[model samples]
Target: MENFNTDLDIAIIGGGAAGFFAAINIAEQNPNLTIAILERGKTGLQKVKISGGGRCNVTHAEFIPSELVTNYPRGEKELLGPFHTFMTGDTIAWFEERGIELKIEEDGRMFPVSNSSQTIIDCFINEAKKHHVKVLYNHSVKSISTEAYGFTLKTNQEDIFCKKLIIATGSNPKIWNLLSDLGHTIVAPVPSLFTFDIKDERIKDIPGVVAKDVEVKVLETDLESEGPLLVTHVGMSAPAILKLSAFGAVELARLDYNFKIAINFICHDGEQCMDALKTIKQDFAKKTVSNSTQFNLPKRLWKKLVIASNINETERWADLNKNQLEALVDQLTNAVFKVTGKSTFKEEFVTAGGIDLKEINFKTFESKRIPNLYFAGEVINVDAVTGGFNFQNAWTSAYIVSQSINS
Candidate 1:
C-alpha cells in the first residue's frame, strides 16, 4: 500500500451522507482550508445509492424542526436545536440550488425528481469537486492518534494529520471502538428499523393486505405505535410496525426478538369494537357475516378475521351468537401475533446505539471530550424510525458541524 504523511485543515473519516455534506459545506465556507474524506469502501455513498429502494429519500417534508425532532426515538431532545439550523426545508433548497429538484411523496418523503439515487450521488460528487474537497476512497482507517494541537490518522493507504477532524462513520464497530479508546463512550449498538417476523394463519396468505390505521402495542411493555400496518410475506411491516421496531429496539433486543404484540386494526378498544360489531350485525342481519366488512377494512382482511373468529362463509349476521360476535370483535381490535424474530428492512437498516449522546455537544456536533473532534449521522447515538427522518438527522448535524468548523 502507498504510504504518505500530509497535514490538512480538516479530515472527515467517512464518505457517506453526513461526511459528504460536511466536507462540501466546510470547504465552501473556507476555501483556503484543505479537506479530505477518507472512505473505507472502493466507492462511497453505497447506502445512499440503495436508500428508499434506490430513490434516495433525501428528507421528510416536515417543515417544523420541533415536530421533525419527534420522529427520532433517541436524539429527539438533542436534535431540536440542530434541526433549527438545518432541516428538511433547508435540505430541499440545498439540492434545488444545485440544479436538482426534489418531489415530496404522499407520505411526506422527499426524493429527487429524477426518481434515482444516482441524482443524489451525482450532486454530492459535483459539490465535492466544485468545493475542492478531496475524496480518498479505499482508505480504511487503522488508528487515530491525538497530538497537542491536532490529530494524526493512520489509514491503510497513508497517514495524515489534521487540525480538525470529523467522524461520520455511521455504525461501524471499528470506528466506535477507536472512539472508545480515545476516552469516548460508545453505546452498545442494536438493530433498529426492522420488521417483525410472525407466523399466523390470519396473515398467512394475505401478504399485501394493509390496515390503513392501526395501533400496535408490545405485550407486557409500554411500547406502542400508531400508523398504517402492512401484512408482509415474512411478517408485519409498514409505519406502524416499523415505528415500534425502532422505538422498542433496545427493549425487544432484550426480549431475544421473541415476544407478543397486540394489534388494534381499527384503532378501537375491545369494548368499542364490540359495540360497533353489534351495530353492524343489526344493520346487515340479512347479509352473510363473512361477506360484510366493517370499519372500512379490506375485504380479504375481513374474511381472515371472520374465519379466525369461527364464522363460516355462509353464516348470516342474524345467526351470529353473542360469543361469535365477541370473537369477531376480539380478532378485529385485540389481535395478538407472536413475533418469532426480526428482519432488516432492506438498505434502510439503522442502529439505535452509537457514540453516547452525552459525549458530544449538540450546539456544535463536537465531542466534549476532544476539542475539534465532531460527529454526525448514525455515528452518534441518534436514529429515527423508517421514513426520511434518519437522513434529516444526518443533514442537520452535518450542517451544524460545518457551521461550527467555519466559525
Candidate 2:
C-alpha cells in the first residue's frame, strides 16, 4: 500500500455508474472543490458497458417514486426518500440535458437513443471531463481511514486525503470487506437475476419459445412473478422467472438451487383453467387428445404435455374421462418442473447483498456511524428486479450522496 497524499475535497472509490454520477453531481455543485475517482480496474463502467447487452438500460420510465422503489427487494423502504428526491424522470432529464437522448422500450426500460452503450459511456466520460472530475483507473484503494477533519484513502498506486469519502464500488465482495474493516456490517452476498435450470424434456428442444405472459409460483414459497417466460435449452427463463429469481435469490441458494416450480403458462387460475378445459373437451370430444389442448399452448408443447400427463397421444378426447380432464386442467394451471441449477443472465445480473442499508443514512447516503464516510450504488444492500431498476438505484443513491458532500 503506497501512501502518497493528494489533498482533495472528495475521494470516491469505484468508477462505475454510481461513482461517476456522484462525481458529476458533486463537481457540478461545487466546482472549486477537488474530486477524484479511484477505480481498481483498467476501465471504468464495466457493468455499464455490458448492461442491456451493450445498449445500457439507463433507467425505467416509471415516474412514480413509490411504484418505482417497489421493484427493489432489499432497500425498498430506505430508497423511498432518495427516490423522492431524484427519480427516474429526473435521470432521463439529466442525460437529456447532457445531449444524450433516451428512448423507452415497450417494456418501459429506457436506453440511449443511439442504441449503443458507448453513447452512455461517452456521456459520462464527457460529463466528468466537463465538470473537471479526475478519474484514476487501475488505482485500487487498499484501505480508508477517517481523521477529524477528513479521510485518508490508501490505494495500490498512491494514498489520497479528502475532506469527504464516498464508496461507490458497486456489488463486489472485496468492497464490502473493506467496509467491514471500516466498522460497517454487511448483508451476506448472494446471486440475483439468474435463470433457472429445469431438467425437463418439455422445454429442452424449444429453447427459444417465449410466452408473452406467464405466472411462476415456487412450490413451497409465496414468491411469484407475472410476466414473459422463455424456454431455454436447460430450462426456463424470461422477465417473470428473472424477477422471481431475484426475490428468492437467498432462499433458492439455501435450497442448493433444487426446488419444484409450478409454471402457469397461460397465467390463469385453477378454476379458470378447469372451466376452459371443460369447454375445450366438450368441443373436441371426437378429436384425438393430442390434437386438442386445454389452452392455446404452442403446438410444439402439446406433445410434451401429453407425455407428461401420462395420456396416450392417440387417445381420443372422448376417452378422456372426468379424471383425465382434471389432470389436464391441473397440468395447465400448475405445470411442475424441477429446478436443478441456475444460469447467469449477464445482461441484467446483479448481487443481492452488500453494505447493510441501516448503517448508511438514506437521506444523504452518508454513514451514520462514520461521519464524512458515505456509500452509493450496489455496494449497499440494495437490489431490484430487472428492467432498469438497478440503474435507478445507482442514480438515486449517487444523487443523495453528492448533495451531502461538503464543498
Candidate 3:
C-alpha cells in the first residue's frame, strides 16, 4: 500500500470500538474517500477485545428507542433520537449482513454466537481493509490544531492532515486536554459502572450468595435501584448495585468513595416483613430461625441476617421475642453497610464525564463548536449501564457519524 496520494479526507483518532466502527462504515460507504485511523496502541480494538468478559456484548435486546435510551444515565435524553436511527435492530442487521450472528442472553445482552470478541474485531479489521481504511498504529496524537480548510493532528510519529476529523478516544486525558484547548468544555471525568467495596460482619465469609430482587439505596441520597444482588468477597454487586453506580457516578464521586448504602435483602416493606415473620414464627414454631430461609433468600445470606439480628443459630422461630422479631424485620428490610471504595466492574473501566454534550449535535454526532469535527462513544460525555448498553451507544453514534460524513 502507498503512503497516500495526499492528505487524508478523513482522520479518525483512537482505534477502539467507536473509531474502528466509524472508520469502517464511513469508508465502506464512501469508497473513494481517503481515510486513516490513528491508533496509539500496537493494535486497535483493545476495549472490544476485553469488553463483556471477552465475548464483546454488541448491543442489548431492547427494541424501543425510548426504552433503550433509559439505560444511559448521562445521554438518556440526547440518545433517544439517535437510537431511532441505528439502534439494536440495525446493529444486529448490520452484523448479520456481514455473515455474523448474534445471540441474546437471558439478561438481554447480545453477543456473538461464537462467544468471542475476536469475531467482532476480525470483522472490523477485514471491513476496514476491504474499504481501504489505513490503520496506523503507535501514532498517538500529541495535539490537535485547526487549519483553514481542515485540521492538523500532531502525533508521536508524524503530523497528519485531514479535511474532517473524528475523535473516538474513550476516557483519554490527553485527548480531553486537547479538546479542552480547542475551546470545548470538558466535564471532569469520574469512574462509572464500578462495584462497591465493603467490609461488614454480615457479609463476611459469604462471597457467592445471591438474593434475587433486592432493593438498594444510597443512604441520604435519592439514588436507589433494585434487582438481583450478589454478595462478593468485597461487598455487594450485580444489577442492583451496578445500576446505582452508573446513575450515581457523579454524586458518588463527589462523596470521595465513602458513603453508606441501605440494602433491602428481601425487597419487602417493613410492616409486611414484620407480619410475615410473625406468621413464620407461628407456622415454623419448632424450626430453628437460622435454619429456615424465607422470602426466597439464599440460606447462607438468611443465616447471616438472622445472626446479625441477634438471634442465635439454634434459636427457634417461636423463641423470637417481640424486640427480636422487630430486629429481624429491620435487618431484612433495611440493612445498611459502609462502602469503603469501589472496584472496576470486570476489566470494563467506564468514565461518566467527557466533552460536554451540548457541544455536539446529536443529529450528525458532529461538533457544533468545531465544524467538520465529530465525537463518538465515551468521548462525548455519553455512557450507559452494563449489559450491552455502552456498545449500543457506540454503534448508534458511529453509524450516524458515518452517514453524516459520507454526505
Candidate 4:
C-alpha cells in the first residue's frame, strides 16, 4: 500500500457514490483545498458499477421532493430538509452539467442515455480527476479522531489529517464500527431491498412472470407497496416486493429473517374484483374457467389461480357456483402467499439501519454532537426502495453536506 502524509482540507472515507460526488463537489467549489478519497476495495465505485444490473439506475425522475422522498423507508423524515436543497432534479442537472444525460423510464427509473453504468462511473472518475481529487484505492480507514484544529484518520496505508471528514463508507458494518468508535451512534444494520421466498405451487413454474401493479403486505405489519411484482425462481421480486422488503427490513431481521408475506395479485379499490368476476362468468360462460381471466395474467398463473381457487380447469365458466366465483375473486384480488424467508436483491440492495437520524442534523447531514463531522449515503440510517431513490439519498445528503462544509 502507498503511504502519504499530505494534509488535506477534506478526507472522505469510502469511494462510493456519495464519497466521490462529495469530493468532486467540494474540490470544484474550493479549488485551492486538497481533497482525498480513501477506498478499501481494489476499485472505487463498485456499487455504482454493479447497480441496476450494470446500467446504473441513477435517480428517479420525480420532481416533487415530498413525493420522491416517500420511497425511503428509513430516512423519509430526515431527508425532507435535504431534498429541499438538492432533489432528483438537482441530481439530473449535476450529471448533465458533466456531459452525461439521463433518461427516465416509464417506471420513473433514470438511467444514462448511454444505457451503461460505465457512463456514470466514467463521469465521476473524470470529474474527480478534473478537480484533482486524490483517490487512494485499497486504503481502508481503520479509525478517525477529532482534534481542536481538525480530524485525524488512521488507515492501513498511512495516517492522515484533514480539516473536515465525511463518512460515506456506505452500509458496511466495519465502516459503521469505525464511526461508532469515534463516538457516533450507529443503528444496527439490517438487509433492505430483498425478495420474499415463497414456496407455493401457484408461482413455482412461472418464475419470470411479472405483475405491473400489485400490492404486497406483510402479514402482521402495516408495510405494503403497490408496483411491479416479479415472480422469481426462488420466490417473488420486482419494485413492489422490493419496496415491501425495505419497509419490513428491520422487523424481518428481528424475526430471524422468517416471515409470511401476503400478496394481492391485483389491486382493486373496493368491490371491483367481485364485479369483474361476475362479468367474466357472464361474458365467458362457454369458455373453460381456467381460460377466462379478467386481466392479462400469465397463462401459467391463470392455471395456478384456478387450482388454488379449487375450480376445475376444464369446468365451463357458466358451471361456476356463487361460492366458486367469490373464491376466484378473492384469489385474484387478495392472493396470499406464505413467505418463508428472504433473499438479497443483488441489483440494488441497501441496509435499513445506520447512524441514528436523530443524532445527525438533517439540514447539513452533520453530526450534532461532533463538530465538522458529517455523514452521508448508506453510512447513515437512511435507505430507500429501489428505482434511484437510494442514489437520490446519497446525492441529497452529499449535496447538503457539501454546502454545510463550505458554509
Candidate 5:
C-alpha cells in the first residue's frame, strides 16, 4: 500500500456535479489553499454528459427562493434559507460569468444555448483547471477517518490527509455506510422519479399518445398529480405519473410497487363529465360515438375508452343507451389502472433517501455532529422532482459550502 505524505487543505470525494462545483468554488474563494478531488471513475462528470439527453438541464428558471424550494420534496423546509442565499438566479449568473449562456425552455428547464451537455462538462473542466483544483480520477476512496489535525482519506492509490472534507457522492450506498460509521444517520434509499408500468388495453400499443393536462391519483393513497400524461409501450410516463412516482416513492415502495391508480383523462368531476358527455351525445347524435373524440383527448385513446364502456365502433350517439352513457362517464372520470412495477426515467435515476437532513446544517451544509465535514447534493436527504431543480440544489449547496469555508 502506498501513502501520499503531502496533505491537502481540502479534499472532495466524488467528481460529479456537486463535487466539482464545490471544488471550483472553494478554490476560487481561497486560491492559496491546496485542494484535491478524488473520483472513483476514470472520467468524471458522466452524469452531466448524459443529463437532459446530452443538453444538460442546468437549472430551472424559478427565481423566487420559497417557490423554488417547493420542488424539492425532502429538503423543502431546511433549504429555505440556503436557497434564499444562493439559488437559480445565482446559478445562472455563475454560468453566464463562465461564458456559458443558459436558455429556459417552455417548461422552465434551463440549458446551455449550445444545447449540448459537453458544454457544461467543458466549463467545469476548464474552471477547475483555471482555479488550480487538482482532480484525481481513478482514485477510489477506501475509507474516511477523523484524525487529530484533520481527516485521513484512504484510497486505492494512496492515503491523503486534508484539513476539511466534503462528500458529494450522490446516492452511493457505500459512502452512506461510511458516513453511518462516522455517526451520521443514513436514510434507507428508495428509487424515486420512475414511470409506472401498466398493461391495459387502453394504453397498450399507443406508446406516443399524450394527454395534456390530466389529473392522476394513486388509489387508496393521498398521492395525486396533474400535468401531461403520456402512454408508453410498457405503461405510462410524463409529468403526471412522474410526479406521483416521486411524491409516493416511499409509500409505493412499502406497497412493493404493486398498486392501483385512477386517472381523470378529462380532469372533470363525475357530474360535470356526465353532463358534458350528454351534451356531446346530443350535439353528435348522428355521428358514431367511437368516431367523435371529445374532451380534446387523442382519438386513439378516446376510441379505447369508448370501447371499454361497451359502446361499439358502429354505435351512433343517438343509439347509445343511458347505461352506456354512464359507463362512458365513469371511464372518463375515474378510470383505474393497475401498476405492476416501475421503470427509470431516462438518465435521471434519482433516489429519495440519503444522509438524514436533520444531521446537517443547511447554513453551511456542514455536519452538525462532526465539524469540518461537509455534504452537498444527493448525499444528504434532499431530492427534487424532474426538471433542473436537482442540479440547482447541487449548485446552491456547493456554493454555500464554499462561502462558509471562506467565512
Candidate 6:
C-alpha cells in the first residue's frame, strides 16, 4: 500500500459471474481500463460450471423489466431502472453476439443450447482474455482501504491500488465485513431459495408426485405462492415452494425455518370442491375414491390425500359420507404441512441479503456512501427466486457497471 503504484485502473473483487462480466465488458468498451479480477479461489466461475445441473442457466425468458423485477424479493424497486438499462433480452443478445446460442425451457429458464456450463465459462474466459482483463486467481482479499485516488485492496498475495473499485462478490460475509469496515451497511444474509422439510402421512412416500398447479400459503403469515408443486422425499419443492422461500426468506428465517404451510392441492375453493365432489360421487359412484385421481393431481398424491381424509382405499365414491366429503374438501383445499426446517441446494444456494439497496445509486450502481465505489450482482441485497433470474441479475448489474465505467 505504501508504494501506491496503482496496480489496476479498475479493480474487480471476486471472479464469479458478475466480477468477470463487469471486467470483460469494461475492458472491451474502454480498451484502456486496466482491469483485473481478484479471485480468491484457485479457479474462477465454479458456480457457472454447475448451475442448471451443469447446463448453466444464463437468464430467464422474461423480456419485460417490470415482470422480470417481480421475481426478485429484494431490490425489486431499485433494480427496475437497472433492468430497463440491461436485462434478460440484453443478456441473451450479449451471449448470442459471442457465438453462444441459448434455448428456453418450457418453464422460461434459458440455457446454452450446447447443454453445458462449460460453454458459458469458456465464453466469459475468452471474452476476458480477448479484452485483456487480467484475472488474478488465489488473491483472497483480506481488507480494503479507501485512498484519495481510488482504493487499496490487501489480498493474500499483495496490496493492489486501483483508480475505481467494483465489488461483485456474491454473499461473501468476509467481503461484506470489509465493506462494512469501509463504512458501508450490509443487510444480514438469509437463505433465499430453499425447500420446506415436512414429514406428513399425506406427503410421505409420495415423492416425485407433481401437482400441475397448486396454491401454498405460510400459515398465520401473509406469505403465499402459486405454481406447480412437487412432492419430494423430504417435503415440497418446485416454483411454488421456491417462490415462497425467496419472498419469505427473512420471515421464515425469523421463524427459525419452522412454520406451517397450507397447500391447496386442487387450487379450488372448498365449496366448489365440495360441489364437484358431489357431482363426481354421482358420476363415478362405482369408481374407487383413491383410484380416481381428481384435479389432475398425480395418483400417488391423490391417494395419500384421500386416505388422509379418512377415505379407505377400497371405498367407492358413492360410499363417502357427509363428514368424509367435508374432510376430503378440507384436505384438498387447506391441507397443512408443518415445515420443520429447510434444505438448501449447495451448488445453487442464494442469499436474500447483502449491501443495502438504499446505499447504492441504481442509476449508476455506484455507492452514494463512497465515491468511485461500484457494486453489482448478489453482493447487493437483491436476490430472486429460482429460474435463471439470479444469473440475469448478475448479467444486468455487471453490464450496468461496465456501462457506468465507460460513461
Question: lDDT by residue for model 6 over 265-341, one digit each (tens)?
Answer: 88889999999999999999999999999888888888988999999999999899999999999999999889999
| Per-residue lDDT of 29 in model 6 | 80
Poorest 10 consecutive residues by lDDT, candidate 5: 1-10
**How does model 1 score by TM-score?**
0.97
Please state the error at residue 260 of candidate 2 in Å: 1.2
Q: Write the per-residue lDDT of candidate 2 for residues 329-389, one digit (tens) a residue.
A: 6677788999999998664568899888878888888898899888989988999888889
For residues 1-407, could you state the per-residue lDDT of candidate 5 as single tens digits?
22344499999998999999999998888899998888998899988998898899999999898899888878889999998899888899999999999999999999999999999999999999999898888888888999987899888888899999999989899899989999999999999899989999988877999999899999899999999999998999998998898888899999999999998999899999989888888999999988889999999999999999999999999999989999898889899999999999556789999999999988899999899999978889889889998899999989998998889
Candidate 2: TM-score?
Answer: 0.94
Candidate 5 collision pairs: none
User: Each model's TM-score?
Assistant: 0.97, 0.94, 0.98, 0.95, 0.98, 0.98
Instruction: Report every candidate's CA lDDT.
Output: 0.91, 0.85, 0.91, 0.84, 0.91, 0.91
The list of candidate 2 runs beyond 4 A from truth reads: 1-5, 292-294, 346-348
Worst 10 residues of 3 by lDDT: 1-10
- The regions of model 4 sitting more than 4 angstroms off are 1-5, 269-271
Report clash pairs, candidate 6. none
Model 4 weakest 10-residue run by lDDT: 261-270
Candidate 1 local Cα displacement, residue 261, angstroms:
0.8
Which of 2 and 5 is the better model by lDDT? 5
Ranking by lDDT: 3, 1, 6, 5, 2, 4
